[model samples]
Target: MINYKSTLIPALLIIVAIACNRPKAAPAKGNAVWDSVLQNVQTAPVKEEDASECIKLNGQIQANEDHQAKVYALASGKIKSVNVALGDKVQKNQTLAVLQSMEIAASSNDLVLAESNVAMTKKNLETTKDLYEGNLATSRDYTSAQVDYNKALSELNRAKQVQAITGGRNAVYELKAPLSGYVIERNISGNSQVRQDNSNPLFTVADLSNVWVIANVYESDISRIHNGDAVSVTTLANPNTPLDGKIDKIYNVLDPATRTMKVRISMPNPNNTLMPDMFVTVKVNAQPASSMLTIPSQAIVLDNSKNFVVVKDAKGLHKKEITVIKRVDPKAYIQGLSAGEQVVTNSQVFIYQALSE
Candidate 1:
């Protein structure tokens, strides 16, 4: 109980002092001043886009007339003449070379002889008939002469046809070209054994005025390609110049090995520039269905988890979060940012930092 009154009075006086002269707590980390500064520095407003277009794509160059051929001789005889050389231009029905062999000519001569003999017998039979009517010639004699004449007529007709070319006929022959084109290949030289041997071709010809640009289309895009679709192509050799063409055909079946479909395009190789088996790039333009919202790329700022744009929202000063679809040519095509929203175009990063604090 010693000094109880004294201790109670001192405690009450200390409480009274705290209430009368209380020290103010420190200011919070963020407040109105930071917001005001960000608003002052906000960039100029964003403008709406006026037009849209297709994306530029890549393509390749191709040869139109790269033909592969296999040739065989019709008449078997040692090769006589090979007029066309490899890579020589030839005309349609042009004589490539003349083949010489005793076998072919002999058949024709035999046919001529048979026809002459037939003519002689016909004259003799007429005389025999006249004599038989007079009874001056015996029946057996007349009959024998008639039978011999009939046999002669059949032999003469057979000779004219030249049926036995394999063994009976031997003569020089001429082999003519099937079409007019550049001779890409020739198996026969000055004198090679060309007795109907299929292992060799006399010559291979191709027309190269126009070229085919064959492109390998991935299976995913197979459905999008069709006949007459517009296409653009470029080559690694001459990438600066691009060629225009249309899809001539799209193969129905996909290649199992490459998982690609063959798309054929027809383009002129004027001055004969393009070649076969060259690798190239190809692009087919696909039509779009709807429109997309776009603006100059500088308007958007991305941070942490969300992309933001310093926008003048319902609240006097604030930052807006948006979704960016794609960035093309200093312009950002977006989905979430609506049309007519005023977005800060130039200074998004500084504003974001100011707003954060």
Candidate 2:
């Protein structure tokens, strides 16, 4: 203890050096540090929107059945030639295929026989009329000749009508399109045998000017959807381009295996962008049950099984707890936030964490 003052001086010098070198503690929340962070954050006002819940459902693009035509072979024959292919655009009454059929050949033969019989009967009638005029033939003979000629003429006309109905020329049946459309299916090929009674269509042509979006709604969501409900559709091929339409039909029946009902949305496809069988996503903007408060979904932060929104006031930014009613893209229906209040949408999580800490 003789040199206590001298030793204390050295110890105080070492303590001062250590204190000067120590790192500074972080700035407190709601201070200058947070002010800088808030400058970069983005905010939006809470607004009230109609509480129309969006029901997302899977769908498939289909040809409009109302505008589709199924082409069938007129008679049993071997396909002589296929004039069109699958996905070929055709006009109404355009020849699709040629079939060489025995039925048509038989009709051609019957027509020839009718024509020959008519010529012979006409000659006979002329001869009988001359003989009757010269008093060499009886009136009954003239009448009989006239009657036979008339019968032959009737038979010839019937043969011609049958040929027209059969749609055959020169013993070849020509399959013609009933409507103007793109061929969506082709079941017959060159040299393939077709039966007169075959139930399947030779080709399926559909007008793609309009299309149907068939969406499947689960049983639980059926009550929320109805006919004439507005909807938007997106496809994997062109997701950025959304087509809008209304639900024109709702199938009252449900698929037992899927336990879902189908709703039909009719949309105009002016560009033919929507193709049949293409999978799509459907968003039905169902009728609003009521009105509710909404905010940008990004403003809401989830933490510890609770939702919070960073609300800015005259004082500073504060994390306020909220109850999320539902979350649709870009907007979230929330409670505990009033309309006109500004909430941070960008970098909200970082600010929330800083305030919580």
Candidate 3:
């Protein structure tokens, strides 16, 4: 009670110190000279540079369907032996499995008959030609022999073609890969009964050297995308690895369910790391804009359908309408802004509000 006056003086000084240390808010209405510095408003000059616009899309990694093959038994048979397992790498024309069937045996017999007929008819043609030259055979008889020889030759040619597809040695058929690739599927095993009419195939061999990136282009983005656009694909499993590719195909029709058109990009997968059905992000690089002027996105103010920016000049701040050509985050490519011009990057909304009033 004796130091009440001293206590009152110290409390008042503390109150005044707290008030001076607090941060000040930007004024509602003020000129650059009056309050811009006090509000800490900043400006940056417009710059010109070559910049690329990219559209990011979600897609999936798939085996290049064109470079893949489905192995089907040439004829109905029971699988005798499966020589390869799933994920096994195989070379072109490598035998993958062996099958045993009466159908295969019948094909072998037909090939043998065709061969025998060719040999027998060839001998007859030689004899008949000699007889005709010696005046011992009629012209019609020689012609008949020639026709038989031609028929036998045609049959033999057809048989050889069939035999290549339906390979059989002692009623066992060998299923061979058509291309060098890893085995993606194994539908048949030892002693499994495979049918020629079955919908499913025995194995799927796919060349993993290059893969397909299938992306869906929405209706809004379809007009901007074109074939041969550069694309970068990254997988979530290994985000550090990015694969480069190009758009090779854009389907003409739209998907009924998704209402998006499918686009295909070919990506090189030399390491065999990109697997089918892996989710990935595809960044399609659009044509670069040359010497476009850009400013910080925060400087531009959107009003209704029109956009404006606050320009600080010798006179003061003034609002100028601008047309945004493209926008990358934090920057906008605009038509009205000139290079070397100063525009407010922050606290522009305060200027916009005062100008609107």
Candidate 4:
């Protein structure tokens, strides 16, 4: 009763100690001022996308066979001059090489002999006709002259046809391009001997305006890929820029040696950027069997072997555990997230850690 001031002071001190030991309250929901970390966080809405699996396979760039031409010598000859080199662009019917052929020379001689015989027979026929009209020649003689003149004319026409078929002009044969394209192969040079029986082509011209991407798929993947499936192709020369295409052909036959089936994708090469035999990577977007929710790959946070995404809503920021079905670059197909929901993408790990704590 006598020391009232001292008793009150001790009691107040005890109360202040208990308050210091108690836990601090969490910041209010959606209060940016209280949660300074929210100021730097970025968010994106979850999207619903068709679920798909990507099948990566090795591929090659090939010139379209439809627009390619293999030039072969029609006759045996010595190549006098080659007007084109490998990689040179040429036009249709452009002279590629000049060949001096012995066969052509023989044909020319035959043509000359035929023309001379025709001239001689025509003169004889005229004389015989005149004689018959004057009763100095028999009717059989006139008929024989007409037959001889007709035979000579036939021989002359045959000679001309032989020369035309041999492509012989002035005893020389000119090798010309069958189509307008770049000469991709040149096997003959000036003074080289060529034979009609040669199996190898003398020159190969290809139109680079359209090309094909031939990709190989494993045996296990054959059932997954189909015609009309979308694909992305990238070459070593241009890896960053991917070219879009579709699987236009599926070679049903499998390679016995490789145990893989081949698929073909057609692409337009307007600038001639795609070259023949260029190695490439092909990514086939296989058709989806169902739909799933998608989010930015960066939004995912891995902790304790579990994936989580920090979701932001009107109530507050919260960490929700999610299951990842697949991950394509820049996108992660997932479960446990709804479309149109916002999730933190940037600085999400920090936000997730804070939310977990």
Candidate 5:
């Protein structure tokens, strides 16, 4: 009560000063200055036309089965020498390793013995035939000689066939590549015992010139994918590189655990840059649907709570709230916007900042 009059007058004066001196909010978004700047910004009308949609999924690069080979041991043996390691490129029929097998040695000895018998029997058959014609030997004797000679010849042929199939000489056998490719895996090392019936292969070779992209389509997205659909594949390992391919196969089986179906895409790897098990991104372009309102993706400005775009008209610029339906790269399908409307496509941050104030 003692100072009420003095404080009240000063408070009233302060309020009047603030009211007079406080700056006014800047003129609405598109003044003459903004119009000049807007000249530099590109604008495009929202188009109502069928637009292709794309489905994105995570996938892995795999070697094409048709171009891949799994090399197994032809016979039980000890690995003598491994000529190729993982990632080594090899040519067709190139020896990948050598195996030391006692069984092969026995086969080699038998082949040598069979050759010698064939040579000896040929001479004996010639002599026996001549003796029979000259009356120097009985018919029974000639017949017995001919039958034994034929039997020995058959045995020699069998031994040769075995040697040819096994690719063995002395006590060693060679494991050769069936196709030209890079070795992606090596299961057996030098001096390792390998069995003929091993469930796994000793080496895996792939002609990486062509590869497969395996993508999992969730149960919900399976309907959008089909065989022969065009797709693009990319990898984080090499972001600049993108591979084009098509859906070559769709597996009938669904993975019960993952609730997804496998989709196979064959992609050409001209530089052999793609490798098996490399994580990759797959995008399949789905067919365009009926026309809808769409705008360039950059035109929309996102804020704390909503997305907005600056629409220009004879009246000037105004902020318009929009509902984005589906966004593809560089384009956005949206609602609350109409076709033939002019929306700011670039420098949105500058326009938005000026107007927000």
Candidate 6:
């Protein structure tokens, strides 16, 4: 009786295990895997973008056209008077002032003496010609008189030119504007001493119709900039408004110290509001495109080892390295990234922390 009970209990234990272990309906392997995949797709979390696609680049603002003219006297002299003041508008051929020059006075006196000599020689030549025709004077005497008269005539003409340049006696040296514009600089006072040897400009006149915006571009990004490309500029003085302009020049030489290249933009200032050497922010636009593969500019994580992006994968957040091709206005054209895939934008640090654990 004890042996039968033990054997029956063992058989009952095996039967119970088989019944519990067997699948209820023997599901198909293909369908099971498909179902599991479907579940994953439904439960997978969407990544929130931590940053926007916008790329903010630094730049500067300035004028399109600007020039400075150094005012100097052709003949050295003491300043007799100054007619214009600083920031005064002068016209072309407008006399700025007069000057009293000893050199001019001497030239004028010499011119007067030359004129008198020429007149006297002309009268003497006339008398000699009459005497030679009447057989009262020799041909050699007439020739000598003729030579003197010719020399006197030449000297008189040269003297007249000198006197004219001196503006009569005390060279009324007039500093005139070459072009009609404002006097932006004044290096001389009412009686400031000016010299030809000195390099300092006595006065400077500038036409502030247009100005140039000079921008410093990084060494790596200089290729995008080309001559005649479009550009925009801004200033801290006028933050909201961006002044429109174009790419006028791209400097070939790179600055080794700053590791930057120079880019120039020309902008108009009809009201003469813009000045030369004003601080500004500049934006240089390369080309227009219909569409491009773009990503958030700030989404790119740069670490010591590599540059990468966090992707929302099936298991969890994954960081993958990427290559950036072009950085346009709002987005970055890049490779090693797929479209329509959710990426983490906001709270990247927190997500990365969770992923690290």
Clashing pairs in 5: none
- TM agreement with the true structure for every prediction: 0.54, 0.83, 0.66, 0.77, 0.82, 0.61
Q: Rank the candidates by TM-score, best first.
A: 2, 5, 4, 3, 6, 1
- Which residue ranges in model 6 land beyond 4 Å of their true spot? 1-68, 163-171, 212-223, 249-267, 287-291, 295-357
Which is better, 2 or 6, measured by lDDT?
Answer: 2
Better of 5 and 6 by TM-score: 5
178-221 in candidate 4: lDDT tens per residue?
A: 89999988899788899989999999999999999999999999
lDDT of 6 by residue, 110-224 (tens): 8888999999999999999999999999999999999999999999999889766545464445667777777777777677665545577666777667666778888777766
RMSD (Cα, Å) for all candidates, in order, is 17.1, 9.8, 8.9, 10.2, 9.0, 15.3
TM-score of candidate 2 relative to the true fold: 0.83
Q: For residues 200-291, could you state the per-residue lDDT of candidate 2 as single tens digits?
A: 99999999999999999999999999888889899999899888889999999999999999999988998899999999999999988688
Using TM-score, give the best candidate's number: 2
Residue 85 miss distance in model 5 (angstroms): 1.5
Q: Over 4 Å off in model 1, which ranges?
A: 1-71, 102-170, 197-200, 292-357
Off by over 4 Å in 4: 1-34, 52-54, 121-155, 285-288, 302-306, 314-318, 349-357
Clashes of each: 20, 0, 0, 0, 0, 19
Task: Compare the candidates by lDDT and give the number of the best one.
Answer: 2
Q: What is the RMSD, in Å, between candidate 4 and the native fold over all Cα?
A: 10.2
- Model 1 Cα displacement at 302 (Å)? 12
Error of 5 at 150 (Å): 2.5
